[model samples]
Structure formats: structure tokens, C-alpha cells
Target: MTSQIAAGLLICLCATAWRMMRSLPAWLRLATGAVLLAGLTAAVVQMVGSPLQPVFVATGAAAVVWEQVVVAAWWLLAARLLVEVLRSTLFNRGLAAKGRLQGDLLAGLIYLAAVLTVVDTVLDLPIRALLATSGVIAIVLGLALQSTLADVFSGIAVGIERPFNIGDRVWLEGPIEGVVDQVNWRSVRIRTDGGDIATVPHSVAAKSRVINRSVPTPQRSDSVRIPCAASVPPERVAELVRHALLLSPRILAQPQPAVALVRIGRRSNEYEIGFAVASSNDLWHAKSTLLEQVLRQFRSAGVETADRPGGGATSEPDPASGSRRFLAIPLFHDIADDQRERLCRQALSRSLEPGDALFRQGDTEGSLFFVASGVMEVTRTVGARSSSLGRIGAGDYIGEIGLLTGAPHAATITALTPSDVLELRKEHLAPLLAETPHLMHAFEASARRGQALFDRRVAASVGAETVPPGQLLARIRDYFRVHHVRPGPDAHAARRHPAAQANSPPGGD
Candidate 1:
């Protein structure tokens, strides 16, 4: 009866081990392997008294060996289960999750300890006694694994210091620069930009200098130096540099750029333009772009570019009127020339690449945008899907509704081609509106049209009811602080009519 029960249990253990192969944990796999070996030995033991053979191993000691292996396998399975429980209840928590290598190492140690405990308790093995007797051999083995021990300790130090995470962009001394792929007990694997995986020992990683680009912040400070002729006013030179920087949409609006004359030489003045870009991913590219822009602007203004510290003097008047860009758009037609020039100076010019997002839906900034060139696609996200609103082209504007009404963007706007846009932010509008009280009315009709478009899109997107214009105008007046301006019919729909084609907003031209 004992032999039959042991045979059944052994068969069950083998089946269980086969089922556990899907698990990724090395310790669990090891324990499963041990179970398989024990089950094979137990099957032979069960056949000892059967017709297969009087004793499968032809010796009683062989049977005892099989039983001892069973004890060890059982202990290993118990340890593996305990490790799983600990992993779920504790080791998988936030901080511990960051130290996965350490967790695996600790689990491996627990598995070895379980084997030792089983040897001493069930098999009556004297583990400590053997170690004491073979102290010299133990010392020799430790010396043999010195490098391995060093790696384990070094890995622990790296984990604690955590200079970089698994996905962080890092560069080490020598040719080890890439994204960290994995951190293990003995080494780290880096996936280089070339798609090759490089495994480096933790000891080497701990000893070398590791620069983590993603840490602290990804923004980078850059400086561009250019030589300008003494003819152009320093203020005009600064303005030109600023305009060039603004043209690149990747540059952030905050931490405003600074341009200064660093050195005044006899022939030319050396100006240094210092600015921060959005990221450090392409430091060289950003520097190259700024240099190109500075040179182009200098040439267009006929400001001689000097090779060295000195500059040559040349004079060329700016042909384009300051208000030319604004006057092209019909919305600002009523503003006085001086006030229009102020708006133009306050506006920032941006060149956007095809597929770049001008603004996302639900953004609350009140900034008007004019499409100087190229086309724009407007979309509204409804639930899990998106619906197209319409397209805006040269001289057509969007975001004025949000800019004037202080409401969330009704739709997302994206560039359909390499496009140029003039952005009029709140800072540019508040002073103009506060000073010229009547100027507020210029936006009233435009605001109503924008709201109508938003309402129409909302209705078309989800079949929702249209909002009453009176209510929308009320909200608009409160947002723009234009209670004095009487509510009027929206000009957008009327302008779209055949009879009013002359008053229609400019399309792509």
C-alpha cells in the first residue's frame, strides 16, 4: 500500500512539474526540475517489488537515495510556493518592483537554504559538520568564485544607487552608450541605437562614469554665436535672432531666450544667443538649425556676416510692413494702424511641420492663431472616436474662440502641410483690449461664428442638440468682458452664403 501511494504521488509530481514550465521565474523552474528527477527515481522504487525487478537499483541504498531526493524535491516546492506568496504580497510593491534583480537573487538564496534545511532535518545530513571538516576546500571554492562574488556585491550597489532605470537613456565610458534594456544580478543589457544588445558586467558598470540623459530633466541649454556688422542697431539684431528662434515650433515658449552683445570689436560685434530647446535628443541638430536661421535672417536684412569677431557695416531697409501679416486677416481690419502694429509685434511666428498638432481639444488657453500659409485639419474627439470639423487655410483663423472667450478649445487643430502660423497669446490681447475698449467688439462677431462652428461640430459628432446663440453670446460677453457690445447675428454663416462670397474668409492662396 505504501509503495502504491508513493508511486501515485510521484506521478502527480511529474505532471505538476510539466505544467509549471510556463512560469518565468528561474527558482520555480529549478524546483520543478528537481520534482521531475525525484518522480523518475520514485517510479523505479515502486517497481522494486513488482515484476519489473526485485530491486530496481539492485541495492537497498539506492532506494534510500530515491527517498532522500523525494524529501529534497518536496522542500524545494514548498520554498518556491513561499517565494510566490511573498512576491505577490510584498516583493511586487512599488519600490521592490524597481529592484527585480535583487528580488530574484533573494529568491534563489531562499531555495538553496530550503535544500540545506531538508538535508539536515529529513536526511540526517550534517551540513555544518562537513563544511567544518572541509574548511580548506571551502576556502578554495570561495577564491575560485571571487569575481562572481564581486559582481553580486557590485550589482547590489548599482541597484541601491539607481543612477538610471531600465528604460533610461545612458552613456557610459567607452562604447557603452544606449538605452538600458535590463538589469540582472550579474550584468546589465543595453540596447544600442543600432539594435544590438550589449551585456556589460555590473562591476564594470559600477566603476565607470554613467551619464543619464533622462534624469533631472531632458531640456538642454544651447548658445549660438554670430558676428554682425556695426551698422544695424543692437536692438534690431536681437529682434532678428528672437524671430528666428520663434520660427522653430520645437522651442518652448517659457524661459524666454536672451540675446546679448558679448564682444564689441572694430569690424563686427559678437552676439551670443542663449536659449533652451525642448529636449536633448538632438543637441547637434538644434545647434545647426539655430545657426542656419541666424545666418538667413542676417542675409535677408543685409547685415554682413563676419568670419571672426569683427563685422562689416551694411544697411538694408525692411520692406514688409509690421502690420502686413495682420492686415491680411480680416478679423483685425477695424483696429487702428498703431494698435495693429502692436498686435503684430506681440504675435509669435511659428513654422510647423506636416502632422504637427497646433493645439489639442480641451486646452483652455485663450490664444488666437492665424494660418499664414498651408492648411490645417480640425477634429473633435467624441468618446472613443474622432470626427472631422473642417479645415483652415491661409488667413483663416481658429482658437480665437478659446482665446477671446476663455473657454476650452472646441476642437483639435493639426497642420496638414509644412505651415506657418501667427500666434496671438493672452499677453498680447489683454493690454490691447484693456486700452482700446471698442477694439473688443471686433472679436464679438468672430467669436460668435467660432462658437457656431463648435456647436455644429459637436452636434454632428454625437448627434447632440445645438446650443442657442443667445446663451453662447452671453457666455462670450462674460469671458471677453464685453457686456457693453450688443449681441449680433453670427457673420460666419452669412459670409458662407453665395451672395456674401466677397466677405467670406480667405481660403488657401
Candidate 2:
């Protein structure tokens, strides 16, 4: 009867294990339960059926030890696998979905408890005595490991609060800046931009002053300092700095930009050009580009940036006086002084009140206009739908696209308020470009660059709604599974291809 009951129990356990294996992927579900059942059966048979037999007692004791080993191994392996899989899935879902280390710790504890329960049952241990002994040992260990315990508890608190996560750019109290590399039970890892890894204890990190550039938003504020001779007017310096920053594609428009006289050095007045960036990840790239553009503009204008150590002090040139005051416009800088003067004379200065229409959509591309002051609204009409592309402010040039390509005006340009514009007629621009072939190339290059900028903005707006490529591919794979599509010849071929197989590292046989 005992043999028959054991066989029945074994059959039932195997059938349950098979069902579980079929339900979950092999990698996700461990067969610990089946192993535990087999061990329990052997233990029961040895202990109850042949209690006084020395061989049965020895066999049961061995089986009990083996069961404990299996349980511990399974618990550790399953816990590790579960944490890794959950972390990966959650992280890929979104920034908000990332799992905290506290959850992982909790999973580990639960696995430990489950393994202990199995071992206690298999060995027929007295739970009350074991609990009493464990309590006494814990008390002694806790006193000896006060600091370690603090760190562990602090780690749990930090994980729960989540001041920052992996990939976050953070500046700690010591003003240490780095990207978060890892968050573990007792310490946090950060990778500094200088290519060094920083390991900060959780106890310190939990209470340290931290500035997370990736939290709230990834945007960061950056500043570019441009020094000028003390004599240059502050207002003029601010205007120049503002114009340069606005033209760059990388700089954000909202929150606008700020320019201030930061300091007065011994030889020069330093002005700080400050702007906000969309991401700290791209901060270096944006700063480099803005500085490059600013330098280019200053050089083109023939503006002296600073006084040399030995050179005599040079006073700022007056914009109103006859003394040559350079304008930083790219087009103006390209032409010769005499030609520029002629072009300036030929250009018409037009003023329009608010609500005035400068040019309607479909109008002939007759002339290009540069905004001298005030704002102009550029609106496009497609059938009944009308969209405002953007507003152009002072120092911004427009209508260049139509004038260059001879295409009809793509949008209507209307004055948002009283505005002044410098109109360069196509006829006047033609002769000047014809006289100077190199000038044509400069104008075309600038125009092309402007068009590319416009296209990028349009693309960014359109692409914002699209899903990431990886996510889309995952969804497609899931869809195939749901539809029960049989793997085709092409699928088999893809899997069997050398290129596909090459994704995994080569192994030496």
C-alpha cells in the first residue's frame, strides 16, 4: 500500500511539473517543486516505513541534506533570473517603469524563506527551537554589524525613494557629476565623464546633496562666456550674443536665452551667454556648436573680442558714427565693402503696422526680406487647414527661400506688430551675385543650411509620435505568436544564416 501511494504521488508530481514547464518558458520557471516532491517521498518512505532500520535512517538523512542543497541552489538561481528578467522588461518599457533594488531584495528574502520552509519540512526540524536559536544569533550579529546594517537599511530607503536611477546625470554635494552606473544593496555606482567609476555608499548617498539632471527632465542649463574690450556697450554685447544663440539649431527657444555682464576682468569685460538645453547628454555638443557660431560671427564683424597683454586699449566703434561698425550678418560679411554699400543703398526699408500682410501664399518670389525690428508671423494654408510655422523676430531673415529658388511663396508672411524690414529685390541681388561668383555660393550654402534646419524641425514634430524600433519589433514578434503563424522557410533560412548566427560569440570546440 505504501509503495502504491508513493508511485501515485510521484506520477501526480511529474504531471504537474510537465504542465508548469509547458506553461512557462524553460528559462523563466525552475523545476524546484518537482525535485522537492521526489526528495519528500524518499524521506517519508525511509522515516515512517522502516524507522529503526540503520540503512533506511542513513538513506533518509542523505536525502534530507541533498534536498536542502537543491532548495538553496534553486532559490538563488530563480531569484537572480527573476530579478534580471523583471529589470530588463521594466527598464525597456519606459523611464518610469524601472524596478527599484528594494523590490529585488524583497524577492531574495521571499525565495530564502521558501527554501528554508522546504528544508525544515524535509528534515522534520522543530520550528520553535530553530526560531529561538535564530533570534539569539541575529541579535548578536546586529550589534556587531551596526554600520553595515545602517547601510543596508539606507539602501532600502534610497531604492524606495529613487532620487535617481541608472543613466541619470547627477551632481552630488561635493559637486561630483556623473552618470549613474548601478544601484546595489549597499552602494551606488556612478560613471564620471572623465572616464572614472565612483562607488558611493548607500548610507552617504541617501543623505547627500544630489542634483539629478535626468530627473524632472533631462534638460540642463549651460553658459558660454565671451569677453570683449571694456569700451563695448553692454546693450550691444547682449544683442550680439542673443542673435548668435537664436540662430543655432541646438539651442532651445522657450525659457528663451539670457545674457548678462558676468564680470569685469583687468583687461576685458566678460559677458555670459546662458541658455537651456534639452538634454545634459547633448550638452557638450550644443555648447561646442554655439561657441563655434559665436566666434564665427564675432570674427566676421571684425569685432575685437579682448585686449592683448601688450596691445593698446581699443575703444568700441559707434554704430551711428561714420566709423565702420561691422554688422554680423553672414550675407553682409560675404560681399565687398563697396558692393555691400551699393547693396545697402539699393535695399528698400519697409515698415508695416500690425495685421498688415507682407506677402500672401502663392505670391511670386520677387524679393527677400530681413527683419530689422518687431515680429512677423509665417503661416501656411493647406486646403482649409492653416498652421503657423513660427514667428520671426528682429535680426531674423525670411523670404530667402522664395527669392533663391524662384518658387512661389510657401507661406503667408504677416506682420505681428509694427515691423521694419530690409527688402533685397531679386533684380538687385542678381547683378551683385553675377559680378561676384563666389558670393553666389555663399548665399546658396546659407540658404541650404536654413532649409535643412526647417526640415529637421518638421521631422522631429512628426516623429515624436512614432514608437521606437526595438519596441515595434517586439510587438510584431508577439503578434506572430498570438496569431499562431507557423515558422516559414524564410524564417528558418534567417535563423540558419551565418550572419544571424554571428550575433553570438564564437566558441572553440
Candidate 3:
């Protein structure tokens, strides 16, 4: 009866150990299996023979085997129990949930403490003397791992300070700039915008000056400078450049752009066009665009750029480029080449700054502006709220009816970037169309198409009533005063008159 009971107990223990094998770590699983095997063998020997019996005593193999079994059960069982406790109670909590439990510093410390406890309790080993010698051992280890210790301490400091988090963009004093991808024990790994991975030692990174571009705010303030002849009025330069920058889509709309006369010399005046963008990534592009549009406007207005030291030299683009762009417009496509050329010659080129309004809703100005480059956003205001109506870019023109028919603009056109527009003002447009009656058909068709586009976007925005192209044409003719031709000379002679040129440069120059 006693032998059968020992055999039954061994079978029960083995079944329990087998059930838990998958949950154990590899070392723990081996320990558990070794311990259970020893326990089973002890139980089997107990059940198979009587102790100190004649046959059992002769060989004494069972006694030696039992001593080994006892040692294995003592150590391995303690290790398995401790491991289970550590995994279930500690690892499964907050750290495990975040997938960072493995190799965690605090957890490793806990494991060491548990191992010491098991050594003292289960092995019956007194470890107080070992604790006393630990200081000497630590000193030897410290000297061998001097660099590693520095990195570890630095990493700890970084964790506590939390200067930057994973995924934050940082520019370091070491000329390294990238987005932080991981923060490890000894180093930080970052992925640069160019797609290169950089590993920075924690000790160096901790000591370096760092700019966290992603923190506080990602918006970047930037400026573009243009040197203008001092003879040009400061107000004129500011107004022209401000309008030009308002056209850029990259620029921010608020905190309104400011132009400062930063430096003034006998030969040249330095004007800084200060503005902000939604992101630092756009800053360089925004500066490039502002410079291009501002310079183009100054050149077209005959406002010569003053040459200065360190101010990059200016290059004037081909004069024929503007005329060629003018000819590409649908309204000018049907108009005779000579008529288009005269119109282009008389047209005033304006630079528009981002968020600058070309014309407001219900504007009565009879002017057509064509987007030579950059973008324009058309918006409609109902009471105090505004909704986007549509947008236009290079090769697109706005205010056709206002230019050809003298009609009030139904929507407001705001610049989305530093933009250039060839403006055919009332003085330029009225006389041109009056002399060239055949151009009216193209004008009507173009006006209708533009109105259709406006109405289509308007319908999406507000679902308001739509206007047919015929009604749009009638409105255009009335506003342009095309019906009653106020006889003025062709655009060429009127524009060439010396008196007009003198008055023009005061504002136009």
C-alpha cells in the first residue's frame, strides 16, 4: 500500500510539470524537467524496493542516485517557483503591456535580489560574507567597463531628464540631425530625413546641445531679403513685396507679414520680408519663392535692384517670357498677335504675397490678373464666415469679366503663395477691347467657363444658386462698359505717351 501511494504521487507531479512546460522560459523549463525527473526517479526507487533490504544494500546505487535527486529537486524547484513569481507578478504588469519588460533595468535588479534570496534559503548557503566581498568585485568590474559605465549613467540621466522623446526631431551640436527612433541603454538611434540611421552614444548626446524642432511648436519663422535701389520709396517696396509674399501657399496667414528697411546705404537699401510658415520643412522653399516673385515684380515695374556686396547678383529673365505667357491666355488666344502684344506691353505686373487679397468680394475694379506663377485661392464670404470657393495656379487667370466687361468680382481672390499676375487694369483693358471688337467672342466664352468653374465650386461649398454663362456674359459687358465704347486710343499709343510714363513710375516704378 505505501509503495503504490509513492508511485501515484510521482505520476501526479510529472503530469503537473508537463502542463506548465510551455509557459516556462527555456532555462526554467529545463530546470523544471530535470527536477521532476529526479523526483520521479526517487519515488520509483522508493516504490520498487525496501530500504536497507539485503538486495538493495548490496549495490548501494539507489542511495547515490537519491542524493543527486535530492540536490536537483532543491535547486531546480526553487528556481522554477521564483521564475514563475517574477513573470506573473512583475513582468505582466505595466512594463509588459508596453512591450518593454525584457532587459528592463528595474526588473533585472529584482531578479538579482530573488536569486540571492533563493541561494540563501534553499541551498542553506550563508551569503553574508559574499555580500562583503561584492564591493571588491564591483571595483574590478567598474575599471574594466569604464566606458560602458559612463554610457549607462548617461542613459539613465537622459531617461530622467527626458529632453526628447522617441520620434522627436532633434538637431545636435555634433552636426547630427534626425528623428529619434529608439532610446537604448548605451545609445540613441535616429533616422534622418534622408533615410539614414544614426547611432549616437548616450554620453555624447547627453552633453551636446540639442534643438528639439518637434517640441513647443513646429512652425518656423523665416525671412527673405531683397536689396532695392534707395531711390525707390520704402512704402512702395514694402507694399509690392508684401503683396508678392501673400500669394505663397507655404506662408502662414496670421500675425501679418512685416517688411523692414533693415539697412540703408547710398547705393542700396536692404529690405527684409519677414514671414512664418506652418512647418520648418517649407521654410527654404518659401524663401526661394518670395525672392523669385519679389524680384520679378521689381523687374517688371522697372524698379531696378541695387547691386550690393554679399547680396547675390540678380538675373533678369527674358522680357519675351511675359509676353509669351500673355499670349497663352484663352482671352488673348483669339485676339490678334499685335493686339495681344500691345496688351501685354501695357499690362502692369504685380507681386502678391501669401494671404494678400487680389480683389475682395463685390469688388468693382475692372482688372484681369493672370497667374504667371504660384497659386491663388478664391473664397466667398457669407456674413463673417468665409468658405473656400476654388483655387488657380500658373497658366490660369482670374477676374476676366472685371477686365473685359468691367464687372464686379463675385468672389474674393487671395494669394496662396508669392505669386505673379499680369494685371490689365481698366485703363489697359477698356481701350484694348473697344478697338478690337472681334476679341469679344473669346472674352465671352472665357468668362462663361470661368463662371462655370466658380459656380461648380460654390455649389460644393454652399449649394447656392448657379449662374449660366449667358447671364455671366451680359454682366461682363455691362461692367466692362463694352456696350458704350468710351473712345480711347489703342493700348500702345496711350501707354507710350510720355506724360503717363512720368505719372506711372511714381506709383508703378
Which segments of model 1 are wrong by more than 4 Å?
A: 1-20, 23-64, 86-100, 133-138, 145-148, 224-234, 260-272, 282-285, 307-311, 315-509
**What are the per-residue Cα lDDT tens digits for candidate 3 across 361-474?**
777677777666666777888899988765655545666656655555677878877777777777766665555443455566655555566323432222122334456555
Report clashes for each candidate as comma-separated counts: 4, 0, 24
User: Among all windows of ten consecutive residues in candidate 1, which has the lowest summed lDDT?
Assistant: 458-467
Clashing pairs in 2: none
The lDDT per prediction is: 0.64, 0.59, 0.63
Residue-level lDDT of model 1, residues 155-229, one tens digit each, is 999998998886777888876878888888898888887799998888999999998876788676778788887
Global CA lDDT of candidate 2, please?
0.59
Q: For model 3, where is the 10-residue window of minimal lDDT?
A: 500-509
Give the per-residue lDDT digits (tens) of candidate 2, residues 101-162: 65566567767765566446444578889889999999999999988888889888887787
Candidate ranking under lDDT, highest first, comes to: 1, 3, 2
C-alpha lDDT of residue 109 in model 1: 90
| Candidate 2 deviant stretches above 4 angstroms | 1-100, 115-154, 166-169, 172-182, 186-209, 244-257, 265-267, 285-303, 307-345, 350-360, 370-379, 384-406, 412-421, 429-509
